[model samples]
Target: MSSTDPDVDHALAYPEPPASPLWHRQGAKARPLTDAQKQRNCELLLLAQHKPRTHRRAEKPACSPT
Candidate 1:
């Protein structure tokens, strides 16, 4: 019944900020995307448009892996 239970706050624990696929600093600035790169990225975007989104249908049993 307490909020401290893992089941109660697991989603909030150590939550990290969303990452941007663009404008990240770790990698060298993507050298101006080549024509090939632009084509590939556009194709990938189109391919991804057809996949269904995933979602947990049942409660994700708590994991204790450490």
Candidate 2:
């Protein structure tokens, strides 16, 4: 067998590579969250957008007679 070929395994004749960290792995699964927790997070984010979602803005502000 020729070792100069690109497909040839040179590590088998030497040694294997070192292991990588957990973050480096691409197949890790994330933990699931409760429905209530998810909703709370979403609501808090929406509140930051400053939209007119409160009852105080249901009607337009009274304009002064000019």
Candidate 3:
């Protein structure tokens, strides 16, 4: 009847379930990027880095009692 009984703990314990079938699946292998693709990626990265960010301001409620 003791709470620390090992037999009670083992009776209530359950084994861990197996992982999903997708867990062991492998997707299509990726191909290496071409030189032109690499250059284009670099240019796009630079443009994104230097792009100006605009801040949005909250406007007053349209229908307020005067």
Candidate 4:
């Protein structure tokens, strides 16, 4: 089989970088965080900690004993 198929090459191409999150931009700035910003950051941290992907467990299969 040929290793240079256009479809395969397209699929293998490097993906675009993910967009920066809100905190990333804030971190880049030198200004101190405000009270509201601190609260927002805390909320974001809590959300990230408990987000579905982070907290989800492997779903159990339904019982099917014969």
Candidate 5:
């Protein structure tokens, strides 16, 4: 029962500490994108979504060019 005992009981020890906070306490603000940046982002996103993907394979080994 002593605090400084060499073998303390399991139940008497303090429970594990709570997890640390993940997010910042201060308020977050959203910034508007510039017109040029917005246009570029839109074009990039459209290109990514509409990209053409082709899988080409040769029947046999490719011949070396002369």
Candidate 6:
């Protein structure tokens, strides 16, 4: 069959690619967090909540002395 032929079956022409590695795969099941990890996460969340917010001041142009 001609490579340029429009009637050629492209799907059957090429070999299937190898499957992706386990680490590269997405949407895999996540393991449940340990008790220590859960407690640390809660402590971090509380600390973050109690942290003060900072406000930035507007920049002023330099004044030239006469």
Model 4 reaches what TM-score against the true structure? 0.34
What is the C-alpha lDDT profile of model 6 across 1-66, one tens digit per residue?
766778855675668878769648578579988877776666555555553743433243232222
lDDT for each candidate structure = 0.55, 0.55, 0.56, 0.56, 0.56, 0.57
What is candidate 3's TM-score against the reference?
Answer: 0.40
The residue-level lDDT of candidate 4 at 27 comes to 40
Q: Model 2: per-residue lDDT, tens digit, 1-66?
A: 667667855557667768767547567567787776676565555555546556342233333222
lDDT of 3 by residue, 1-66 (tens): 676766543553677788989777588877988877776666555555553742432243232222
For the record, the alpha-carbon RMSD of candidate 3 to the native fold, in angstroms, is: 16.2
Worst 10 residues of 4 by lDDT: 57-66
Give the lowest summed-lDDT range of ten residues in model 6.
Answer: 57-66
lDDT of 1 by residue, 1-66 (tens): 577666653566677978876656675555687776776666555555544743433233232322
Clash count, predicted structure 3: 0
Of candidate 5, the 10-residue stretch with the lowest lDDT total is 57-66
lDDT of 5 by residue, 1-66 (tens): 686777855784678877677654557777788776776666555555543743443234333222
Model 6: how far residue 19 lies from native, Å: 24
- lDDT comparison, 1 vs 4, better candidate: 4
Candidate 6: where are CA atoms >4 Å away? 1-27, 53-66
Question: Going through the candidates in order, what is the number of backbone clashes in each?
Answer: 0, 0, 0, 0, 0, 0
lDDT against true structure, model 5: 0.56
Candidate 1 wrong stretches, greater than 4 Å: 1-29, 52-66
Candidate 6: Cα lDDT at 55: 46
**Model 1, TM vs. native:** 0.33
Which of 3 and 6 is ahead in TM-score? 3
Q: What are the runs in model 5 whose C-alpha is more than 4 Å off? A: 1-26, 53-66
- Top candidate on lDDT is 6
User: Highest TM-score: which candidate?
Assistant: 3
